[model samples]
Target: MDARFLGITELTEVPSVAVVIDVMRAYTVAAWAFGRGAEKIVLAESLDEVRALKAVHPDWVALKDGPPAEGFDAVNSPGLLRSADLGGRTVVQKTTAGTVGALAVKDASLVLCAGFVVAEATARVLRRRECDAVTFVVTGEDGRAEEDLACAQYIARRAAGEEVDAADHLRRAMESRAASELTEGVREGAHPDDVALCVELDRFPFAMVAAPDDSLMVLRPYAVPR
Candidate 1:
């Protein structure tokens, strides 16, 4: 199982299997939300798309970055999902990098999203797929998204059957500039504990994968086949 890493710009060239990673609270928040019992998550490409989905399915909850906006159920934060009773409900999530990168993948036969919280589980599932080359999409295509690149590389290494030090990966993620902003509470609607939540390596036990559901890509946990 060979693995390759790509920034968001290279989405078009991705192979049959790919994992879109957003460690700085996008896919990390997604892992937490799934662990908190959200039945499904719609990785929407835009805030307007999220609103339209919510209108069509009022029972579905919507989450986004920063302060609360019109038609959103909550901000994208791990701590907030802690007490959220989202069991049997759908969640619509839209973020600048993560969701956009996911929506941009047009060629992958299988698409997954990841962060350190779900990296190991994601690799496990990928190993079983037996794809020729698994691509890790670093959602933060910008040069400074150290955490995203690190998480993507970590997952790629694991998928290729290499031993990795989880603690070291966590350390790199914690030291990123985005981590500083989150911990300092300078990033809007980000709680101090959110950064802590984001760096919790392999916190979720299942991998998050996506499938086409109407116009939305439905993301949910994928367990090892029984």
Candidate 2:
């Protein structure tokens, strides 16, 4: 069962467990949000949707996402997150790829947010659940980014019961970007600094569990508590 992989359009079903990945920045920001003690995070696919979510959850924080030039409330860059004043607030985030992917897989039995920043922790969470299926939803820029596929392969290798070689995985992932027809402008908007920040494996000691309300619940990195 773990050998299977699926790409989804909308998150409407729940599997026994699900692993959501927004590797470029969304998941990284999510982790940072928790680290800063934010109460929760509501993920939306579009800027309009995020604004609407914020309207109702006024106390909740809102992040607009898009290319840097377009200027979304929060750019999908990790460097920006590190400085954000999330001392005590909930953030509603929308991103080019990450958040939307998260919204797509809402139906999974359990959704655990992930990225290169939290890959090790995420994998540990998966082992603890021992679910019948684990889905990794990749968020791509304009619906296409080599990074997403690289992340998928990384997670897929882990799910396949193979050894996960971080260096090798990154190399493989980067190779696609090198060959991609996409432009530097689209890729650079994610920010090189942000990419570096997000790709630091096991940097955080926590895993984010998605709540019924689509917000996240922070859990210790190792496993779930009884």
Name the best candidate (by TM-score): 1
lDDT of 1 by residue, 1-226 (tens): 6766777776556568888889988898888888878999998878888889899999999999998787888888887777788888899999988888787774579998999898888888877876668777777745248898888888888887899887777788889888988888877867768878888888878899887887678898887552
lDDT of 2 at 66: 51
Candidate 1 residue 47 C-alpha distance from true site, Å: 1.0
lDDT of 1 at 100: 81
lDDT of 2 by residue, 1-226 (tens): 3633344454345555666666666777788777767767766656776667667766677665555543235665667767777767877777666665665666666777777666666666665556556666655544345565566667656645568778866654445552232225454445446656666776777677774552543222233332
**lDDT of each prediction vs. the true structure?**
0.82, 0.61
User: Which residue runs of candidate 1 sit more than 4 Å off their true CA positions?
Assistant: 141-144
Q: How many backbone clashes does candidate 1 have?
A: 0
- Spell out the clash pairs found in candidate 1: none
Pairs in steric clash, model 2:
11-104, 13-107, 13-108, 14-107, 14-108, 14-109, 15-108, 15-109, 61-90
TM-score of each: 0.94, 0.76
